[model samples]
Target: MARALPQPRRASLRRLYDPQSGEELDQALVLWFPGPASATGEDLAELHLHGGRAVVAAIETALGNVKGLRPATAGEFTQRALMNGRIDLTQAEGLGELLSAETEAARRAAVHASEGGIRKKVEQWNDRLLNVSASVEAELDHSDEEDVAAVIGSGLSYRRDCIALAEELERALASPSVERLNEGIRIVLAGPPNSGKSSLINAMTGRDVAIVSAIAGTTRDRIEMAVTRRGYSYILTDTAGLATKTDDPIEAIGIERARQALDAADAILWLGDENPDIASDASIILIHARCDEPERDATPDDRTPVSSKTGAGLSVLWEKIEELASRHIPAESAVFFNERQRRLITEWKNRLEAAAQEEDLLLVGEQLRLARSLCDQITGRAGVEAMLGDIFARFCIGK
Candidate 1:
């Protein structure tokens, strides 16, 4: 490796000429990073090579011939980073999330976690837990005034802190904003046939993603388009019109699918002049679509009037949906965006809650140790060797 460098210890451009075959593979700028400062806390180098496949293949083949040289598997570099304390488990996973992020909201959350924000919070919790554990362990060892006071004091503080943390965990588990960033918030367009559901969806996305037809039951299935509104991803679905007593098998199937879509939606845009009195717990924007060409008994206060063709009241309906989504998530939350993180954190929180109720100092100390172990698992301080391959497999090669 030293002989291949253009200079002894400094980064510089170098040309790769095969020693045995006398063939020049490529020229590249290379930087040799010494141990303890690199991403993996070991000696590493960055070879900024040209992306030509032949050049890359030749280099790889040449290196493969060396006794100790080998190719990196997917996310192997990141796993090395985790193993060497260069980055914790959350930050390592965050790197994967950042690479896969599909929306601005998702990117924001991923970047935050990747940059050690979650690690900082976890460190604070570990410090507090350690203090409580020490206090409990002391109480277990002896029965004295000082030990009793320490136990009582630590228990009170731990109770207050654990309750706060539990509340935060519960809120994070329930919030839709963070989870929807990946799955995408589903907003179903539902109403009678020829009620302009397709046209409204097209207008919302500013693209003709759904077929706009005047014929009833023309759209026989859910036509979903990924719509980005204010940087949040939404699956805007235009479904078959809902009505009773459909003799056509296909139309009936479409209606059943539409009902299924509505059932799964985060919000419903009930578009029509007639209110069908459907039972739903979801937030709905009752939109009297096609108001520009309308005949009805009276426009209800609960339902907004809009026309996709004329672009009337559409902005107001959009505002309503945006507001609903924004209100669902907090401005700043210590939320775990993925299920794996949520599950581990929830386990830790549950242990803390259980430990809070135990009166015996030895039992309480054991529970706290178990709770700390869960946090250790969350940060990959313990018990993660088996899953390392699975975790890093999602990453790109050489990362």
Candidate 2:
């Protein structure tokens, strides 16, 4: 412990001693910040001690005997920051994401959020909403005093503003969700039996995740592997071959699961010679696999011919995959919302849209207020008690 508190916000090297026994302790650098201006909007101190268990334990022991001194619990510092208005809920969530980010894209997106990208957007939306709300309130206040024609004209303008704000929210919602970004784009390999689907997956991932074999139905279940390719994340799935018919019960189950995977895929790598028959919104890439083998049929003009065994055409396939993936990946600088944030914003947008459509000024006003409340929850201004614990629990101690 320091003999005296260091100059505010300045790290000072100091000698340490045990107050109870007057024994010399390790030298350390300490910095102090007075209340209301620090990270938590309260007095704060940092001790940069030598990184050793004994050193930390000694400091903890000395501090433990002091009145009202204890270690922070999980996310306590950040929770306090939120409670004290040092940072909003979105930033806290972003910090959590930053801690767990695995890929470069995830890290960049998390950095944007942690730096108040989403909060600033919410603030702008809130300002616009308040402007529209003010108009609605004014109309309500002067309904009898104002000319009927003038009231109608101004009301139209206010509703237009509401619609514009709703459209903005709609565009934000249309962007790929943060969960999808974190979980990676779902790329499912679907084709007939012995069509080199397994080999293609192993080639794409640069590892043998799925069992490749000449026998049909070797992959009896879905084999999911998350991989990062060229700074983008992808969840590559090698599914059981979609055979025309099956008598075995387990293989049948796997075939059914393969069909399900097709439905959920963001991109399909179809290794079969024929065109895919499944009805899906996912991008389908026709592939002519085993191109290096003798007596192989002519490669179709529309299909991407590839040889997983020799690594031929893998670069072109990767380029095509990356091209499709780029459409789903949001720009690093762009602001995107997580599931909770998106849900709140969606409700807020719905309220705004309803307000724009409603003919009754009173109803419009109510909708505007509800929308504002949702914005509040987005920034942790109100009505977030139930989710606070869940959010904070994501962070470890000393966050």
Candidate 3:
């Protein structure tokens, strides 16, 4: 049997918390509001609580005891806010992100989003789409009196605007790189054995994280650590060195994993002791490691010279990392992040392309509707109960 918890209490008007503990207790109470003066045009009850484990648990117990009050799901409060016209969909998503943000860049991005950056754009597109839908409906209704060409021309103009908006949405979704910005940037270090990869990791993180040894193949696995550089979070992965011949099976596996890391990384620090003959790969920033070595002359035009021993060029390396991190910032217009958003945006793009190529009014209307729905999905304006639940379920119970 599940344990019963207390119901959450309502705070008093003009004051939120009692002076007993200088903390608000989570308990059930009711206060009256004579409304032509309410914020939402309705009498509102404010809930205040002590942000403590026991207090929240007690509140939940109290709420469970009550008949009407249920625990708010992920975005439920925001959903209610939206329904009450307190905020739009974009602002809701932004608030969600803001609550989860761990870095300065992410916080800024979330704030920008919550301020209706995406909402305004989405609303503009929706307005254009609504116009197109109206024109199509008018054509369908007044086909008897209206000239077919004139109606078609009007519909075409609106369709063109819809198509343009779709294209703009697609570009915004792709350009912002929102997922990477929301989550920390992924950066991996790769090089041949004994090229100071572990040392570099330690240097960049300002900690002696990995086992630093002169022995080749010292690091036999992908060692990952979180680092904050210039107030931005980054997942820096130090992978095993890439080498062809290794006697140990473990070392061989580590090498394979290193290759996979390189393939999967957002940016790769291709380290080398001396200038090794290696082709430049996309998304790779070549780094000449062990600059302290007297004999080694590894220096490429694009490669930054770094010495983990004396901490030389580390500042420059951080600058490089920051530069790469900036590329993934989520812009105001971009709302896409997960697979759902991607699929919807792709569908929208496909429909827009189809509408541009085809002259069928019905087909165009259908595509526009699909595009609008997809845009709605981006802001959780459309049916998103399941998604909202999933997103909120991932949060802590009291969040």
- Best candidate, lDDT: 2
What are the per-residue Cα lDDT tens digits for candidate 2 across 3-71?
Answer: 679999999998777878877778999999998999999999988999999998998898888899888
Best by TM-score: 2
Candidate 1, number of clashes: 0
lDDT of each structure? 0.79, 0.89, 0.69
Clash count, one per candidate: 0, 0, 10
Distance from true location, Cα of 245 in model 3, Å? 3.2
Candidate ranking (lDDT, best to worst): 2, 1, 3
Residues 1-399 of candidate 1: C-alpha lDDT, one tens digit per residue: 236544434779878766557678788888887778888888888778899898888888877877888889899888888999999998998898888888777788778889987677777778878877776666666556775766566565556666676676576567653455766777899998888899999888889888887788989999999877776677889999997779999999999999999888888998866675667766788998777775742567888878788898888998898876665543344544566667877887888788778777677778888988977887888898887888799999968
Each prediction's TM-score versus the true structure: 0.87, 0.95, 0.76
Query: After TM-score superposition, what is the CA distance of residue 328 in candidate 3 from its true location, in Å?
Result: 2.7
**Segments of candidate 1 deviating more than 4 angstroms:** 1-10, 146-161, 176-179, 244-252, 274-276, 294-302, 329-335
TM-score rank order: 2, 1, 3
The window of 10 residues in a row where model 3 has the poorest summed lDDT is: 1-10
lDDT, candidate 1, equals: 0.79
lDDT of 1 at 60: 82
Error of 3 at 111 (Å): 1.8
Query: Which pairs clash inside model 1?
Result: none
